[model samples]
Target: MEISVKDLTKKYKDKYALDHVSFSILEPKIYGLLGRNGAGKTTFMEILAGHILATSGEITINNENPFDNQHLIESICLIKEGNNFKRDLSIKNVLCIYSMFYPTWDPDLAEELVKIYGLDKKAKVKTLSKGMESALGIIVGLSSKAPITIFDEPYIGLDAAARRRFYEILLEEYEKEKRIIIFSTHLIDEVSLLFEEILIIQDGRLILREEADVLRHSTCAVTGSIQQVEAFSKDKKVLNKKELAGMMTAFVYCRKEEAVAEGLKAEGIPVQELMIHLTENKGA
Candidate 1:
């Protein structure tokens, strides 16, 4: 399965949500789509899922346009942040509706997850708590077993234990049958480790996209005397630098061993910190 996005642009009146974005997803690995609010992550996902059309450019799945393609649409499942179901539908009704929509839906898994989440199948959607609704969304996304499953902050009200359980199930299901899973969330620290590839967007542009492993070993935070830090950063790729009193800290895309050997305190840069370093405003 392959998803190709070439010059994908989505415009609204005078503002552009996605501006000439291009990327190809060929692997069945878990991908992390990340950005600050209004950074176009949701816009891109909507376009990819065929929920909305782009203003210009194109996105294709297996060489065919995803928009209005029933076959392709059925192969893609998107569980959004919320409002995934009608207010009057029962939990069982929602499951039944989704099971018929996806070609690869698994009923047993859905039932098991419903029990694991301790949800009453007969409960109406409007009556369920926020956490229960989120769990229902998770169940749909996971049980759909679609070729491309997109989750856009679907755990809005889930507690920590429930969220962790969802992550574990995600990994387990992925290993059982590898498929494309695009996850977007603000809680990056909790699930960053599961991302095989990470894409960071800033203000309707693609700022960075690389394998999470590469990002993990490619950057480090170094702290020491202001002069030493500055000198160390002279020849290296520094993403961000901060100074206070007589000391400086720099985030650099290079090995931390060299900085340690040179008598500076250095540690691996966290993925969340890396994303911030690459996307934060520069006082324009």
Candidate 2:
């Protein structure tokens, strides 16, 4: 599935949740939707999911508008952190309802996941713990087999082992059947390996969109003598730096080949570090 978003804007009063954001995703792969807390990730996902309307702009899925379109809606599945189902309903009832909506829904897979997650079929939605609720959401999302599936912080209240199991299952499922999966999480370092591409939104703008490998290699840390580090970093885009005594360490945004020629010790920048350096309190 392909998505084309142009000049997308969502506003409330005088504030813009998404400000003229424009980007096109043509390939189907796992995408990491990342940003600080109020950075419009949810707004962008909601627009694509047709949960809310954009203040201005256009969104087309496979060249057709997804807004309230039944055909496209069936092809999309979005699982948020909380309460996506009726609290009074049983787990079995919830699965039955979702099965009717998603054409590719796998009841068998859902049942299997319910057992694996240790969720009782007779338990009401409200009777389950927070982690159980998230697990149920995960089951629906995976079993839906939607062409475009989104998980917005879907593992809340889960223990470390449970979280790891979900990650493993997610990757295993993705490999078996490829689709456009948009995953948003604050656990960047842990899930960085799962992303084929990365999209970073800051404030209400798209600040960075690049392939995972390209982004990782685009920046490097150079640590050596102050004079040599400064000489190499000159006329280059330096994301961050530190100087102590006679030593200097700088994170410079440049190609690996160029960094090798600088006569300094250099290492590829970590994804977490790159994100921090790029988005950390820009005004401060």
Using lDDT, give the best candidate's number.
1
Off by over 4 Å in 1: 281-284
**Each prediction's Cα lDDT score?**
0.92, 0.90
| Candidate 2 clashes between residue pairs 3 or more apart in a chain or in different chains | none
Q: What TM-score number comes out for model 1? A: 0.97
Which residue runs of candidate 2 sit more than 4 Å off their true CA positions?
256-261, 281-284
- Residue 150's lDDT in candidate 2: 97
lDDT of 1 by residue, 5-27 (tens): 99999999999899999999988
lDDT of 2 by residue, 1-284 (tens): 88999999999999989999999989889999998889999999988998889999988899988888999999999999998889999999999999999998988889888988999989999999999999999999999999999999998989989888888988988999999999998888888989999998888888889999888878889888999889989998888889999999999878767867867788998787777877884831
Reference-based lDDT, residue 204, model 2: 87
Q: How close is candidate 2 to the true structure, as a TM-score?
A: 0.95
- Candidate whose TM-score is highest: 1
lDDT of 1: 0.92
Clash statistics: count for each candidate: 0, 0
